[model samples]
Target: MTSPATPTGSTVPTGAESADAIVVGAGHNGLVAANLLADAGWEVLVLEATESPGGAVRSAQVTAPGYLSDLYSSFYPLGYASPVLAGLDLDRYGLHWTNSPDVLAHLLPDGRAAVINRDLDTTAASLEKFAPGDGDRWRHAYADWREVSGPMLETITRPFPPVRGGVELLRRLRVGGALRLARRLVVPVRKLGDELFEGEGGPALLAGCALHTDLSPEEAGSGVYGWLLAMLGQEVGWPVPVGGAQKITDALVARLTERGGRILYGARVDRVLTARGRAMGVRTAGGGLWRARRAVLADVPAPALFLDLVGPDALPPRLVEDLAHFKWDGSTLKVDWALSAPVPWTNREVATAGTVHLGADLNGLTSYAGALARGEVPRDPFLLVGQMSVADPSHSPPGTESLWSYTHLPFRPNWRAEDLTGHVERMEEVLEAAAPGFRSLIVGRHVAGPADLENGDPSLVGGALGGGTAAAYQQLFLRPVPGLGRPDTPVDRLYLASASAHPGGGVHGAPGANAARAALARDRALTGGLYAGVIGAAHRAVYR
Candidate 1:
């Protein structure tokens, strides 16, 4: 197979093509995998179903021609802190991060705001307003987080079983301290907050962070996520690319192309071509057969990779049955607005934040989440709002704002077109309650529900962000259905490189990095065959 240059100057396969690795999906994870493989001198090819890259990490002028709105994810604390992304040195490829004066603001029902600032003293002071000594408690919690943050991040980002990282964590915290921390992490966010905070401010901040996932404040293990994100914000302010989220994608693509990796857009992979229980290549919907000599990495959801692409016949019966129970996170409904002016918040502190959590107090969040779990939409939805222009001024014209807010919805809601419109109106009302005259400032508005999001990026799988549920039952080794908790799948030479893998969700790029490392490890001259033999045996034992 010969490579030919496309009109856009990217190399594409002229006929049947073979590469050392074929990555299905041009999402950030897939692109990360391609970049790593290309850096190792492999002929890497990425096939994307859409016309562009960056799946959910994309931005566009959806509201208006001049205004830039993040089509999906906006703020990126994980991207800034991720060792995997840092290793890529994306800034060298024109990625610049920008942050607002504050990291986040959670506006209470009474118009009091709990804001998180980069400065410890300022954040503590903000919390102190609610309860006298709550500030000191926050300080103590933050200090504890700092002690274990290094090893904790390493453990979470690295492949599961986290041997080296786990050992390092034990060394850092000691046995008793580690067990205590584990106990805290296992409880519900509500309980964790109640135990740690005397006032509503601290608990509100933590609960708001927990809502980022599908888990409600009452769910066990929600505390860990909430605490992790809150700590990350204090450590590294939630930031956006200077221009837009697309800049992050552009940086990855630039680095990959520089390394001679090729990405073919509009190539929807229809099947994982396997023979003798080994994945050898992929067939696209357009009838293009691309072969992979070393590996095929899928930056797609577990169900799509296993059931749709690989087919049930090729999968073990147990594996197939487990997939039937694979749970997706809540569907999302997002609204983007081109505002004529910045939001006129009741509390000035809310204006300083790049991100805001609105329409919820601590208990409100619980009720909203409960509604979703019961397959019903909350009348007063809890919103995760982004002020893109506040984070990056280039997102909109001077004095104006590129704003977006998203709320969780039931996985399958029986709603008509009018019902969705009514939800949008309700969202606007909630915004208006927090930021008076907010609706008046909107110059344009665009709404994206589950179907629309799925159309834009099939990997989103019904607008369910984070790839899959972040529930305790589906996390860690149980992710994408148990087994080795690594990238290796039941099919040989295939890897799951999406958020469906371990260390689920957030834009950390760990899953992609892990997959790349696995592929490279199994392709090494001396240890390659040995590594493959062991991994293959483990899969056979588990899947059998």
Candidate 2:
């Protein structure tokens, strides 16, 4: 399985057999890291186990020939706003985006809907219908978002212990406002809603966004995610790739290949080969070894990288113990449909929105998340729906529509096919209640349960979407582990470049960008030493 090495440590020239850096898994982040390194003149090689790249950010026409459904992810607000992608100008590489007139809608039990529009005033006015004076509260909250949005996003995406982001936030908010913002960050979404507005729409909208992760509306630190994502919709509309989600990944792969980087499909990395406690390269499942002269960036989940590939024996005992406590997020059940007609919503506002949240108000949302936390399947599950045709007409034939909906479930170590079918039926009933005769329009359908998703992409371990739980104990500095939140690993030349790392999931390439910056810095001996020392000191301070 090993490649021939010369006396001078040169490769035997097996065509992409050697590179300055090797990226495992051709996910968006992996490809992003590869492109960055290749742009820097490093001979980068990317390995993908599947027949294609784009681990989760891919599309399929499972329902019908003309229907393009985003198999995993669809919206790209984060991708559009990503600083790394912005610098790359992926538009030139064929990543055109399309946005709906309205961003999202939260449909209530009574058929009224709360719509989030790109215009702040319009969104505020919509909230006014639920309660008097709520429009002002909405505007006030948006003003706070304006103050901290830049700094908050920078802190999330940048390297850990964001000193620069802290300074900028403090400068913008001043001491009092900054302190208030800090307090809000720790409050539960439920409490945040109560403090801000006295209306169902205000609270329901926030809770709906919080459910995007595995967190309950009552969980501490859930408010931040809810606020952040909702504000992102305001700042940058939840845009979809013109053709499909695959366009984003396709563009990334194109840029990488154009920069002379190579991608090897069907190369499943079986193990990460190490020498003297440093990553050397990877061995594929097909008994072929590729060498990396500088670094190996693993864009797979942390458990897959550490437990399965690297093995517990190779990790420090403390890290191995910590890995045991690693918590996965909730499992998912997704249903994609090729409809003969658009969803006939009871509320007209719902028809205009690209995304919809169904079968939940504030209390229901909390209860649904709480049920998952208690390892129980929710009787009335919360649904996240994507109207592909409404967002971008290219998703299906004219007048026809492509739609998908998904809901979270507690992790069942051994989920069965019958269980998924039952859940799908329950979801159908929920949708039918909201949109009468909804099921009649379905010309074709495809269902992906937890096992199906995991089989398709192991990164969604047990179908936990955000790489892991976004609970207070498992987010930010403690994400993946209690280690410093950078991509650098205890193993030299090995970096964690997956969504399982800091900032945890979404289409943002921050984890990959952070890993590449670390590797790039390491290539410079003096800068590497200094950066390593600083990171080590920070790690000690936190862990001590």
Best by TM-score: 1
Whose lDDT is greatest here?
Answer: 1
Which segments of candidate 2 are over 4 A away from where they belong? Answer: 1-16, 529-544
Clashing pairs in 2: none
Task: Quote the positional error of residue 523 for candidate 1 in Å.
Answer: 1.2
- The Cα local distance difference test for each model comes to 0.89, 0.86
Candidate 2: worst 10 consecutive residues by lDDT?
1-10
RMSD value for candidate 1:
4.7
lDDT per residue (tens digit) for residues 168-240 in model 2:
9999989998899899888999999899888899888888888898888989988987887788898898999
Model 1 per-residue lDDT tens digits across residues 319-405? 888887889998889999999999999899999899999898998998999899999879999989998888889999999999999
At residue 274, candidate 2 shows an lDDT of 75
Candidate 1 lowest-lDDT run of ten:
1-10
